[model samples]
Target: MSSDFEPILMRNVGVAKAADLQVYEARGGYQGIRKALQMSPEELIDEVKKANLRGRGGAGFPAGMKWSFLPKERKVTYLCVNADESEPPTFNNRVLMESDPHQLLEGIMIAGYATRATVAYIYMRGEFTEPFHILQRALNQAYAAGYFGKKILGSDFSMECYIHRGAGAYVCGEETGLIESLEGKRGWPRIKPPFPAVAGLFAKPTVVNNVETLCCLPHIVLRGAAWFTAIGPQGSFGPKLFCVSGPVNRPGCFEESMNITVKDLIYGSKFAQGMIGNKAVKGVFPGGLSMGVLTGDELEMRMDFDSPRKFGLLGLGTAALVVFNEDTDIRDVLLNVTRFYAMESCGQCTQCREGTGWMYKIAQRISLGAGRREDLDILVETTRNMGMMPGLSICGLPDGAAFPIRTLVEKFRAEFEQHIVRQEPGKVERVLRVLN
Candidate 1:
């Protein structure tokens, strides 16, 4: 099925002759920012709220709600754009940062204006060095053009943005971690009572938004909320950029309507090229490792925030759609993902620090052919308990790290059982070395 999908964030990427300012302005770029400058800050926030745009950085929290959390009376609120796309199999944000830095800049400007923020910062992963340069150049251009700095677009609204690069910790993708890193401190999550909005970034009221979340702001401002809402599903409004990777014939990002079924996305003419190696798809990690795996049966489900929730999985996690063919080992995949969370955990939260490591061990054992059937139950129980741990720990790192273990045990029980039944003598030792 040939797709009629037009790329939004990545529309002129690589194809445009010039990636500089002149080319972007000619193609209707910065119009959103120009329009946003005309509206009152409150009106802009209302528009975004009416659009029903949700955060695209794993958690599906409403973008408007997050912005609304800002204390209106505060004079120095900050909008931190999270560009640290550390989630495995998630590359959608990179597309925006690399291809169309202006889109995100425009979004940041709008978000800053809405929240009465005079300064915005783009906290980017260090690995995105190239994109970082691209964005920095874009910000300079915007400043020169009067889109940034005092009296932006001659509207008395001043916003200045700077790019801060992270040292490549997955935890830094978390809002609090990003804040801590931005403050030049150890990237650890702070305990939340004073959520970022109440007290954040030097203890001032602030709003942290993901890159994609901020990128949607300009569109919301330009088209109006109703128009944006009319494009996608009822609850999930606007177009979504779905990144497909791992063993697909055509592995890349594609923008599509939210309600598109997983089957149509993976097998459609515009994506995947009909599965890897012509093998039957055994499972899919629809929203990266944190969201857990959905088997072939669930792949037919719609690709929306609530669709996977109905199957007991979270679907809005980076919108990463990783396809695993029959040749893939579920145990191995789970083990790798578990190990990642374990290594990345900041050790501030006991449940996350300990539970992630423990889960990784069990998953590694199973992948090495030494898993006992009871171990599967233990993995599930431990993860369930850990996920229930108390304290509103800064960031969802604890819960995010634990969900995969719980979901994997529940969704792929047979795979774990097979590992145990086919245990080979001394295979555990070999697997341990490999895992290490």
Candidate 2:
């Protein structure tokens, strides 16, 4: 929570007429692209590498390293900016695009230039009606200002950018699924080995980056990489925006050093400002539902990508924290997340297609006070059989579907058992040790 403030991304968020083109130029908005165009594409790549900026979408992969994966030959390169923002409790992208549309345009220009992508698209979610319109208006302004289209800024580095709206499907949040949807196909994820960097979007070399990931390029290009790296701890460079929502006193999006602990995020005055109504904090999904829950002693863990593993958890996924109060039912929580994944599964992989439905049925029954004696076994066994582990599915959706159910039943086993005990009386005690 402690650091020097620059507010590069949110600089124009609250100002009147902030989305106007002249206002953006007045606030030094597109200067990063101008500076980026002055440097060679290789230099742009190297400068970002030195900055150590990671993807903000979820994976946290090195941005420069991802760009380096593209082949050197200029054979119809493309860049796709992921503005889908489909995950629950993830509204950071929506805020950025709606408030400072030009900042994103500038970032797209720099990222497209660095990757040598002659054509780029912002794959925005269909639900983002306002953000999409704001972006389109900004794009028109940029084109009219000679910042986009044929000969951008009168330089040889030319690229055209467009916005592709997606029907509201969670699978499209995945990169390959987004590409497939962009091609006017169903939103099913494609297999890898030929990643987007080598062959993506019409079988040409491409790069897919998130809205926040592209927004950082301007700062990295304008300021030095050393300045960006100095903002956070080792392996956790740059300022990160944490979307802290749920049962908290002041739930909102907060930008802070990546080193901020989960405890601070929920309790810090500058962040969530402690739990609402002095209610006791029961559990928290530290990084959206995709990452596992933290409870009891695990609340003290730091919010960095690596620190969550100290408790046998996946790394920070989107850094979107959804908290729960002591009064909330654990069974209902399990069923809520289970149903979400089930409905959004894309139903391509056998594991996720079947596993999510099984877990949802069990959780739904348990939440409604009809839990069976052997339901615990069915839940855990179903998750394991679904191969919910990473790299098992076409995309990471199954893993997201698996983590909460696995972690909740593991960490909060007693609570889950209590549901069955209330429904089946002594039957739950019979298989309790096997579950433990």
Task: Name the best candidate (by lDDT).
Answer: 2
lDDT by residue for model 1 (135-200), tens:
889888888988888988878788888888889899888888889999998889777768999898
Candidate 1 displacement at residue 31 in angstroms: 1.5
- In the range 1-436, model 2's lDDT, one tens digit per residue, is 5645666667777899999999989988788998988999999999999998999998889999999999887679899999999888788898889998998899999998898889999999999889988999999999999899877887888889999999889989899999999999999999987998888999988899999989888888888899899887899888788888888999988787788888888998878999989888889998888778888567888888789778767678889999999999998888898899889999889889988987787777677667775777788777666543545678888877777788888888898777666775554344443333
Which 10-residue window of candidate 1 scores lowest in summed lDDT?
A: 385-394
Where does candidate 1 stray beyond 4 Å?
Answer: 1-3, 388-394, 425-436
Once all C-alphas are superposed, what RMSD does model 1 give against the true structure? Answer: 2.3
* lDDT values, one for every candidate: 0.81, 0.85
Residue-level error in angstroms, candidate 1, position 292: 0.8
What is the total number of backbone clashes in candidate 2?
A: 0
